[model samples]
Target chain A: MTCKEAFQEISKYLDGELSEELKRALHEHVGRCAHCKVVFDTTVKTIELYCDGKLFPMPENIRNRLHDLLRRKFHERAV
Target chain B: MHYTSMMALEVNRLEKGTDRLTGKSMSAQPQKATERAESELIAEAKAGNGDAFEELVNRYERRIYRLALRLVGNTQDAEDVLQETFLKAFEHLPDFREDSRFYTWIVRIAVNEGLMKLRKRKSDRSEPIEDAVDDQGQVMPREFRDWKPNPEQLLSQEEMERVLLDAAHKLPASLRTVFMLRDVEELSTGETAEALGLTPGAVKARLFRARFQLREELSKVFKSEKSLDL
Candidate 1:
């Protein structure tokens, strides 16, 4: 596969959606090409960085307010 | 019990006529137990049980908030989306058909609320949320330097979050929503498509563009400049 084809398939490759044939071709392309390898590795890292749950913890105050708002709404409806 | 297990239990009960009064089959299946509990909670909430509804709220609030924060790009609007999502869900709980999982149903509501928040903010702007252009021309990797491993170790969590959020905010809302739902929220492509009212093909294409753009944006910060310079 060419670098362009490999690059286009990176997302599908990571998402586990690539067919076996395309996957093998892209894997071979990245394994041999330094540039495609960097792009593929960094893209993997990019997903990891965003997916870390610590990056965006929900604040306790916000949680409290949400529960409080729900309580009030429920109470008013009950009345 | 699982269907097969339940059938076996029923057959055993019929043959042996034992454990008929103990309800032993219900105790053996954890998956069914959880489903039964959820259905009971839904039924109770639909019958005006506030506590049961709160139980459901507690189950999904953090995830909903995170999704809202990612989509709307702020704590305040995220909070508004969270509050509005549950409020609206509660108001319409009785109308909720059981065909969909409650989480998916609530996620749909949260997405709508987030979209409304985005729409209100973008009213003066001309960019449409649905970006239909072919993004392939823009997706080529210009930065070929490998990123340093363990970037979390290099940057504080807050700094990392800022960098990530800024990169995410760079995409048009269309691609951002698909990426956030499919990647960040870990929703299935089908579920994300359904929530956004787009086809699975659209979701896949936009997800590709979003991931490529985000990687490119982040590479600006995390790339190994020393190697590239050499």
Candidate 2:
């Protein structure tokens, strides 16, 4: 892919929005362009690293309060 | 400006997974949570069953809270947004259509609430706000380099997690929200666009900038470690 074409379609490529023909062209470009290849590879890995993150536990205090508030609302709505 | 810009060209064609319906993404190595059994609870809750609804809150509270924290950049504000978001969702339940998954629907609500909080906080500031990044027609071209010694080779997973979290918090509200939704939460570009009320192209553009900035942060961490090894 021309560097110009790469920048324009990189987001679409990541988002899986590219057509088969375009994907082939981009892949061809990256296969030859060392810089784009590294940038593309690392970008994929970086997103994977973050996506690997676990959801942190909510504080017990807030969880309890949310329960209380929601129960209260549910009851208030029921009545 | 002679800024050194780094581009992350991750073309994970064969490796990545996407939820066909919602476009939710999962890591290549780990399977994400399976489709939640929310239909039963949603039905009961919609009919005014308090206990049933409480169970629903317990299920998604943490996910919503994390999304809020990333968007608003603080615990207190995130908690506030979380509380308001659920209340808003519950109040509007009678109007709910089962077109989308329950988590997707709630997440859309939470995004709205979180962004509202960001806007209010910005207004409360003494200084007039300026664009976080002035938009020029094109992203400036910069020298590209490989992030060698790879993430797995350079740092422990926990170390990577800690530094990435901190760096994520540093992104501006607009960028952070898009990043958290599209990348962190794995929402499809269309879902993200709908939540933020932007076009799909806008979501893609914001996501591009977010990924660019975040890649820069990752480079800094690895570069610093390289020096420490010297």
Candidate 3:
């Protein structure tokens, strides 16, 4: 498969939604093509880091403030 | 004595059968009880029970805040958006049709409110779209920009994460929303499309482009970092 075609299919491949035939074709292409392999590796890594939940942490202060705000709002509405 | 003994045996049989039925009934009770409690809480909140509303908020605060933060790109803006979202949801609680998940409905409200804030800022700044358009209003083609060689070759994972976040911040708001919703939040493409009022195909196209751009940015950063270490 050409680089263009490989790029288009990479997302589906990462999603594990690729058909077996297309997956085999892409695997074969990546095995032989250095450029396609790099793209595939980078794409997969990016998705992994994104899904692993390592990106951000909600601050404790923010959580507390939100809870307090909710309490206050609730009390105001009560009155 | 024989008659009394026969009557006692009959009573024991009935007791055993009732125990079996009660055991089965008890086994099903917790699930039904939880559902009933949820429904009651929702009813009370809708009826203006402030404590019930607070309980709902407590249950979902972290998820809601994270969503707002991801969409708004900053803590302060996220907090503001969260406040506005809950206030609005509370005000409109009576109008909620109950056909959608409460979380989904609140998320929809937060997304809209956050996007509105971004749009307002975008208008005020008058920032030109990257890759200026030509006379035909089509985006001008540009050369592929890659990261420089021989920069910092190796960065810690934390540094790499920082770079990724920076690159994500550079994405246009529309693309960023789709990326965060679909990639970060792991919402299905159809759900993202429904939330954003776009067709599923359009969501796919945008997501693909978003991923492409993000990949380019991240690879550039990694390449530059690798080069610097050398």
Candidate 2 residue lDDT tens string, B14-76? 225543223355432233266345777789888887777777787778878877776665679
Those runs of model 2 whose alpha carbons end farther than 4 Å from true positions after fitting are B1-37, B124-136, B140-143, B148-162, B224-230
Which candidate gets the maximum TM-score versus the true structure? Answer: 1
A1-79 in candidate 3: lDDT tens per residue? Answer: 8867877787666555678788777777766665665566555445444544334566788767766876787778778
True contacts kept of each: 0.58, 0.44, 0.24
Q: What lDDT score is found at residue B198 in candidate 1?
A: 88
Where is the poorest 10-residue window by lDDT in model 3 chain A? A46-55
The models' CA-based lDDT, in order, is: 0.78, 0.68, 0.63
Point out where model 1 deviates above 4 Å: B1-36, B123-128, B132-138, B228-230
**Model 1: clashing residue pairs?**
none
Name the 10 consecutive residues with the lowest summed lDDT in model 2 chain B: B1-10
Tens-place lDDT digits, model 1, residues B1-230:
33324323433442332223342331211354355477888999999999999988887888889888888888999999999999999999999998877888898999999989888988877545656576433567778888876677898877887888788888888888888777666677888888889888888988898888898999898887667432
Better of 2 and 3 by TM-score: 2
What are the candidates' interface root-mean-square deviations?
A: 14.2, 7.0, 20.8
lDDT of 3 by residue, B30-75 (tens): 3543444555767999988877877777666666676777666677
As for DockQ, the candidate ahead, 2 or 3, is 2
* TM-scores of the models, in the order given: 0.84, 0.76, 0.72
Candidate DockQ values, in order, are 0.35, 0.40, 0.20
